[model samples]
Target chain A: MDIQKVTVAGGGVLGSQIALQSAYKGFDVTIWLRSEGSIERAKPKLERLRGIYKSTLEALKTDPSAWCRGLTDSADVPAEKIDELIARVDAAADSIKLTCSYDEAFGEADLVIEAIAEVLSEKEAFYAEACPHMAERAIVCTNSSTLLPSAIVGYTDRPGKFLALHFANNIWKNNTAEVMGQPATSASAYQAVVAFARAIGMIPLELKKEQPGYLLNSMLVPFLNAAEALLANDVADVETIDKAWMLGTGAPLGPFRILDIVGLSTAYNIVAASPDAANPDTTAGKIAAKLKSYIDAGKTGVNAGEGFYKYR
Target chain B: MDIQKVTVAGGGVLGSQIALQSAYKGFDVTIWLRSEGSIERAKPKLERLRGIYKSTLEALKTDPSAWCRGLTDSADVPAEKIDELIARVDAAADSIKLTCSYDEAFGEADLVIEAIAEVLSEKEAFYAEACPHMAERAIVCTNSSTLLPSAIVGYTDRPGKFLALHFANNIWKNNTAEVMGQPATSASAYQAVVAFARAIGMIPLELKKEQPGYLLNSMLVPFLNAAEALLANDVADVETIDKAWMLGTGAPLGPFRILDIVGLSTAYNIVAASPDAANPDTTAGKIAAKLKSYIDAGKTGVNAGEGFYKYR
Candidate 1:
């Protein structure tokens, strides 16, 4: 199926990016917000993204490394053609429509990307409200980082078309879209979503089964947890762990540095939820305690200016 | 304690690198081999490393990105100074002394790096033979990847001076040296080892306690294990898993590629050793079985020309 009209549910960080990137790719895009306040908040985010996209495209003209895969075809675009692409960025930015009504957003959408809150009940209610308005052929994909599609597929009207299309942050640069489908999801719908991911200039990673955390977080969380365990167990300090990973694997950042970017609260909640964290003496419990101390002290993460390491 | 005369026990892959890198930094270096055959085998490896170092230095002269942090001061070296650096590489390669006698290698040595077989009995036997000849002031460090310093400190004469200084592969570029100390190890001795690691152009990651797998593998192994579990559980294929990680994290290589480089046998051994592998229904057991099938087909890793992916 040719996906032209795309409706993105919610106008948050990931949702705004999804809507903007879809429009940037020449898709007729609309962002479905919950309220006027959400629309007001989302407009500035879209504007900021527009400025970022313009500057990034400008950088690509002179520097080859500035080429964002999702924004352009390749790094070797002729200098003259770059101007056209930059114009397209502005055109795409201005083209996106915003609506608070479920009928207006999903009535004719070829694809409805649910990028709302991670709360289960919130997603269920949003799906139920939006389901009646969506087109019969429209495929719905949840852009959930942690929750599984199978758990929520029952709530959606078109279970056969419901799956997942998870994206990494900064979609234009780190252009990976993980397409996962539940057992009930139809093969045609899965293929269509994979093709749609490719149309948006993403490397689509297809998962055969529903895996929690998908592919990226499945690997990342365990790695971060191990590093946190080391710190809580007093095997090494923060800098030592970061330096070891960076110098050893040639990775740009270490676990703690990544945690700083990912936010300590996120790490704290994940650890606190683990069964092992119930006991204070366990490694998970100790990690939770450690993160709580940091969070309580206002050293939440890089966003707060400090976490494992101080950031200016 | 100032270290000058350095002895590297064994002439294996990492042992040769440690000896060469130390010699390159102008230390008086000796490599002790177990037999005449071992000396003959090590000569070619040193010759190969010399070629690599020369070409790498030559590359650094023209391309700033080619500057190996472990080999040179910085990428901004004057073009005229490169010839001198190249000359030093040749000189360092030619200066290394090789011997089979434990007394000849350990006598008057300021530091001894045990880089022999990973087997416990072999390491214990080596330390027993070399301890009598080692100088009273000499600090003994095991370059063991998996074994803890505390586990082998009892074999050495100087328990207070014993520690672990593990180096990553391709030490010229990946120049991380993890320094871990046991409770019996003196603070001064640990500090000396850290300084010595820096003197050899290594970033010393100091671990306060002896952690199995040190800093790198402690985090790396768990990350790889999670990826393996994903594949074993049939959630995703090898390439899908690799692509998700590489794109999502902006890492150069994915877990399977790293596993291929790390060798399937090593991964299999590590997995099979886990207590969970006793049950075939467990993820660890499935991963071990999958790795074993690949190993049985002679697809060991990149070295064997095939594993999860093929290399030219």
Candidate 2:
């Protein structure tokens, strides 16, 4: 119940957002990276996001430095920037530490969030490394959008302490999150996770039972399934489908615009995660099939300049 | 195509909104009612809505009297009000007429709009009765959210001129409309409908083909389907679900609130028209079953002062 040090395993977009938001809430965060390159690539994005977070804090008339817990770049960020990152982390948290070794990661963390590649094996291996070293009461949460909580916790020794915690992007602005608790998860652990989410200004919906993608994606996947088919069949043009629903439903963006934001490659994974029965006859398979082609062709949305639709 | 007179069949909430909006667009429209009581019941509501429309016009800095084409009350509204209604209608359109007979309803009309009951038989009957009286180049459009476009137009003499012209509610402020063309509908017919929609200050989405509920409802039904099921199973309180989605997705209201606004009776009709397999096994069946009980017990929402949730 004495939640203190927290670690985010992986430096992906979601991992970074979770880390940033958690740190903003005054939790000392160490972002563990699998490789030096990920740490380096994630640094600029993290700094840029922090800058945006600063402006957000200003708008809300809150002081960002007041909650500056700490950030540990671990294996990825440039060694030269480590001191500055650690200084910010220290300002946010009472203490901060960084190390390239997995042992150092488990040694100092009270809550470890695994947010690596969504591959089952990759995440399973990461969980195995932390199970023995993490404190008995330390909560371990995943930022997995498509994986079941049972599947991820199955590899851990203290399975009762592991759960899934999803955060909406640009964590500082969007305040929604989903927390999935497995059958073996302790009530205290779920409450701790919820407490941590609340401490960070997140409105978390706790699932009574864990399902793949939990609730948000569970409700949304079927919609995307039909939309992709609609696009493939040329039933309606992209802009029309996008603008129609955007205006009609008051969704911030049309489905395709959202698909672009989530990345075509990521969208393919979500679509593939959905059972075929959810969409049997439609050729929305083109969404995934074409995504792999587009990614292979080096065309990923705003990041790569092209996906389902072009972005500047 | 020479656009002249129009007949709007039905005198319900949606039908009235459509009639009011169409009248505001400078059309001499005769709204056909099902029974004498309906016309009587609609009189005060129509006057109140006209007052709302008048304020809406003032808010937009326009003349209300000059914009109204007509306010014809069917059998329920007395023939004594005919001259006053005709005068209001004539201020906006070239002329206006009121009648109680279905046999003479579509005579000399350039366009016939079916906004009657969602019941297939009821709509089919209207199509059969009205089609013969429509002018040669006249367009037939339905403000149907549930029924298939082809099925309704199938009973018409000129299916090639049939389309679904859907307008959002609160039409005085919201100007989005969906134009769905049936399989047999001619290109010119679709174009003419689109032209009419545009002339009325609506931003039209010309769907390539007719889909059930057209574009907006096709995307929306599933969301409501999921939300309704969640409410039925007590997965979450109705208010929370409404708040979660409305605040989360930025919808004006959650599914339940929308259902209330749309009327439980109408919501039940829409659900019945939807493919049942698309909804949650437990929750999807609840709305219709609940309504059947409610209607039989005379407890429909707003009209009955109670539904899934009560309204003041």
Candidate 3:
């Protein structure tokens, strides 16, 4: 009943991270790509992940500041054991396998983690096809940012095994996994997922009930929304707003800086999802427009390297 | 004319700090207390402040953590300089004259900072009595937390000289001065106050328009409200909420911890002020009731050393 073999469907940013991170934590991970196009996209992503792990290991030896980078340390990794970590990552790389075929990927999966594109239809379609191919005891967990676990649980074969296993973007460094069960999900299934999250070196936060944005985003979004309102309403410029926040509260990063990291496209989508609050004068609409302008210019985020403030 | 003689009305926590800080920066300070009873309260407060300044000076020479305890810097000061800082505090204590008489306190004041109780009627009565005692051309500023600068400007003989000059609780380390002028506030009055703030070693943020909570609180209050809502609605516990925030975003402190520092009575009064949203099911009502119950038990905040979390 232990989750030894983990299959992560979707080889995008979070999916590749989940797959590589699972493998890095000693689980045999298979990343299922939708097609040759996605596989092509995933190759560079997986390669970049390798680079990230290498730099993270190197950073641990010299710079204390290096630890909080996207995919690295929360707890102190003793300097003496740095080589062991590098070796672990190397071994974990060996455990990860990528495939375009669902049958090959999900055949022996102890857990099928869906981290596909966020559209509900895409999720439902993928789940319908992938569920039948999953191993008999395989638990299904979706990494949907906005959609509830119940929204896609009906698409899966085992209702009792379906749940949400959410991760913050920088999986290696910001290692938080929020686990919540759909109404039909069994208590054992929830606990198993929680244990799996812990197995993969994540601090699992169990949400007792279903919350739309979960604990983190529910708190985070309003802050960002307020910041955006300040910017769009011309209350303050971006830099001033950032300075005020940094000075007032000793936060390491400002809201816009975080928005740049979170990706403007993703931010826009989140804003766009809430259409009821879309008047130009309203905060949500203004945020959407601001993000859309950046997105239109191909300045999506750190990946594209130009969001609120330009990145080199 | 240079702001040489500064008078701070009221000998409360912030008022005493303002007077002490102004004196530390070499401005002759006069503190106006209400009565002999308050003079007793002010005695221990002033004595404690002197002790704080001395320890802060001594701590600068050794520990790096002493900087933010209502004083600035983590740099190593030579033992000679530490003694000089202590001497300066003693000299500053010499420069600070205390009186219950408004006439004696304001006779030759260049700048008068009102840091009295928050109640508007209390402010109006104080201003009505004290305005006639002020030296001609002495700029007046109210350190009202939530009240508009316009609310009490009418009571001042020189409405053009009156404005809002708000400071955060721990004035020395958190050296921010939010200067906002009411409609009748003169441009020269605003500039002079800005210069005066700089003289006292403060970074003065000039708000072009009056914002009720000004810049910091406007951004901060919503974040706190959201956190309180989460706590009240049974979404998450305090520690988990704080952990999620700290881990998700690299903020130095969380909302509940901040509430603890801000004190529960102040927070309760803030929530209670908006009486329209008092339904039990609403987030605002839940927060109000939660704060009320805690305050009822006299578990007010860090001053009592037991708020959201017990402190030693």
Pick by lDDT: 2 or 3, better one: 3
State the fraction of real interface contacts model 1 keeps: 0.86
Ranking by TM-score: 1, 3, 2
Better of 1 and 3 by TM-score: 1
Model 3 chain B poorest ten-residue lDDT run: B68-77
Candidate 1's TM-score reads 0.94
Model 2, A161-218: lDDT tens digits are: 8888887766655566777788899998988998888787777676666666555555
lDDT tens readout by residue for model 3, B1-312: 578999999999899999999998889899998998987788788888888888777877777667653344436557797788789899997778889998898888999999999998999899999989988889999999889988788778998899999988778888888888988889998999999887887878777767778777877878888888788887778888888888898898988888888888888777877774478877788899999888888778888879998986
Computed on C-alphas against the true complex, the DockQ of each candidate is 0.76, 0.32, 0.58
What TM-scores do the predictions have? 0.94, 0.79, 0.92
Write the residue-wise lDDT of candidate 2 on B183-296 in tens digits.
899999889888887766677887887676666666666767666655555455566567656545555766676666557777677667656624546455665675566667
RMSD of 1: 2.3
TM-score, chain A, candidate 3: 0.87
Q: Is the docking of candidate 3 incorrect, acceptable, medium or high quality?
A: medium
The residue-by-residue lDDT of candidate 3 on A59-144, one tens digit each, is 87887777743334453677768778788887877667889898999999999999988899998799888888887799999999
Instruction: TM-score for candidate 2, please give it.
Output: 0.79
